[model samples]
Target: METPIKIDISVIVPSYNGMPLFKTSLDSVLAQEGVIYEVLVGNDSPSDGETKNYLNQIENKDLRVFHNEKNLGLFGNLNNLIKHAKGDIVHLWSQDDIMNPNCLLETVKFHNSHPNIAYAFSRVEVINEHDEVIDKTPLSNNDTMSALTHTLTSLMAGSVPGNIANVSIRKNIFETYGYFDVNLKYSGDFEFWCRITEHLPVGIIQKYLIKLRRHTGQLSRNPKMWIYRIEENDAILETLLNRVPKNKLKYINRGLKWRVYNQYFGLYLNLLRSGDNKEAQAFLRVIKKYSNISGFYFRYVILKILSVIKRDKKFLHWLYYKQAFGNNGK
Candidate 1:
């Protein structure tokens, strides 16, 4: 058999309370074939007994470890890891996910053949807590952000949003963009992706390149359950809108379905949580500013009126029961 081709690739996996999944993550990176790669495991755990054990016995000379005394969140941890990476190609690995043995092997092959392409992403198999493949994320490998936005947003609606595990951006994009924003607890990935994708077509592998294990241990979709997502997402939206030109992002627009859905539901929760009718009315005004008035607005208004009245309001609840949810505990 002939010797496999070798190319230096830096794999950065940022860990936070990932003791149980760290070994599987590390082993997956180590299993790459026909490539020279370094596994840099950055631990952000409160105490590192378990993670430290794995790091100490990582017999591979290519595997190096960094212990972050203070736990930097995802964006901060990723920025820190990038600074320590020294390989020709770099990959951002999730500490809880498993990379396919052919992931780096395939990516390197694509990179070697297509030197002009600065970034490439692969298809990822989303697994449940038990690690069974439940879904897959398709990538838009072309170099335009507008086209990518349309492609990715469709994936989001289809249920599997693109993630860092499926992405392998080129080292040059990082050199130009600098680092991921530390200010955002969420939505930072999209900001970075939007910027890099501005110049290059994304490269993609149609095969399932990684197994994304989702469970209680991960923060996968808890943020969506938040009643204040509209408030939070609105803040990030404004930040991006200010920096990026609207015409530049032609395929995208102000009135997206996610924005509408989140705003409508978030306002409902806000009305219920409001201490008094006055605060609730103020929230309603803000909601109108974000979206156009519709029938849903009238439905919520009636619910608030009933909530505000000081006298018996059993009838109001029943009326809103039919209007708001189409059933009132029937």
Candidate 2:
């Protein structure tokens, strides 16, 4: 008789219409080196028959599939998988993201070495729809407080931690701190990270261990997603305001306001360029409610003046590219 394999890690992939990309994600998980892991896929009521057929054809015994009768949102599906996971270390892998072959081995090793750290994460490489590298996010080696403060500041400044695919948490962290908030549409991972950082130190593995896919179909591209993200960010900021040290609060607040104003102004510009005058006017009203930052208002007026002269989508696209990618043009 063969000896039973002891699972050291459980990768929970919460999938909704995750076909095509989900295969790549699963293959990456299966390819991890020097670690005994199981891949648990929680299917949130995929509407297509092809997706169902694909799930049925998965032949690996280590890969388990759970079907939900109704469509559970992302976090809800994650919660379902967490309950079924048997490993001490649990990783939430997005269906669209690909993991490096050594991702599991390194994260598990880091966790074993630093037993006190609640979770560990590696740096991530951002990829486009074609699996081409677009950007890389390298996390600095900082103590718990410093890292937490920096992350909060960045969030307030309109920058998000690109993808949570590189992170692996102890199963106990969720038991102690609670699961991902289902209420949040886009910022659940951000809020969960903040919550964990409040009580425990997080380990940073500097290697690029995961590829985060960004495409037109992703939630980040949806205009409505931005509204949810901004609202959730405000709530997260308020929570962090009460938790962070008094000395850092002022600086954090300033960054938060700057980021908020910039995001609102960017949205306003996008609406104007798209010729959605009604939505643009409505967004202006929303922007006014956030802050009275003079620079943002000035930029908004200039963009509006330019729009009045001629609605040049090409110019708007170029300006957006410059702001986002700078001279490198990546």
Candidate 3:
């Protein structure tokens, strides 16, 4: 009699509102060449029949699907999926992202080799809605949590040089550290990684193994939600600041500058979409308040002022994102 294979990792994908991209994600999982794993898909949007049915039609026996009667949003869905996850490690799947075929096999190898590492991540490639490569993110494993803070507002989970799909966390972390906080209207993922990367040991695979798709219909499309997200992140920074050592103020300064920039940047994008600039300056006010007009942030703030003297919107996006994400191209 043949012995049943034991699953090495369980990938839990929390999905909603994605029609075209989900299939590509599933296909990538189905194409894996090595490693025995189970793919658990939490269909957060139960009413999303098109997404549910497409997931149900997959031929792989390693797939499991669950449905929520109503949408639980991103955090709730991930919480529910983790409860049902049986793997040693869990990969939070985003519906719109794509993973390389070797994603699982390679990740598992890293986790085993570096047992002290709580989880592992790889570099990510940014793609258009059409899956065309638009840009590549900095995936260098050079103290990401500290390096990114040198320019951005908060140490982001997504900015951990990888996408969620490229991350495989030991289920024990969730068991001990607790689930992603639901009260964080946004920034929950960033907060989760903040908890992990700060204390726990982590390692990286050093390969571009995932894609982050940028599109118009993404949920953060609601500028109000982004505004709220920014606010929530501000609170997180304050809480973290209280806990970090006074010697780390340099990190805090860098983070503060990034936060203020994004506050205005989000407002800027919303204004462009809505054709309103008068109220948008409210966000700009806070940005300028903390902007390092003479320092590292100088490279960004000066460009925008120069561009405005030159009259350009494209320069605005570049300048704003350079502030929000550390000139790490969006």
Candidate lDDT (C-alpha), each: 0.63, 0.75, 0.67
Clashes of 1: 5
Question: What's the TM-score of every candidate structure?
Answer: 0.70, 0.82, 0.77
- Model 2 regions lying over 4 Å from their true place: 1-5, 139-151, 154-160, 293-295, 299-330
lDDT: worst 10-residue window of model 3: 143-152
Q: Candidate 1's error at 98, in angstroms?
A: 1.1
> Which residue runs of candidate 3 sit more than 4 Å off their true CA positions?
1-4, 139-162, 220-223, 262-274, 277-330
Whichever of 1 and 3 has more lDDT, that candidate is 3
For model 2 the local lDDT of residue 168 reads 85
| Tens digit of per-residue lDDT, candidate 2, span 200-223 | 666777778899888998887876
Off by over 4 Å in 1: 1-7, 138-161, 224-289, 292-330
* Cα lDDT tens digits for candidate 1, 87-179: 767888898899988888787776666665546667778888777888866655443224334233322232123578767766766888778
Q: Tell me which residue pairs clash in candidate 3.
A: none
Cα error, residue 134 of model 1, in Å, equals 1.7
The best candidate in terms of TM-score: 2
Whole-model lDDT for model 1 versus the true structure?
A: 0.63
Tell me the tens digit of each residue's lDDT in model 3 across 78-194: 888888877787777788788788888878887777766556667788888778999986656452234234213334223353346667788888887899888775678777876
Write down the lDDT that model 2 would get: 0.75
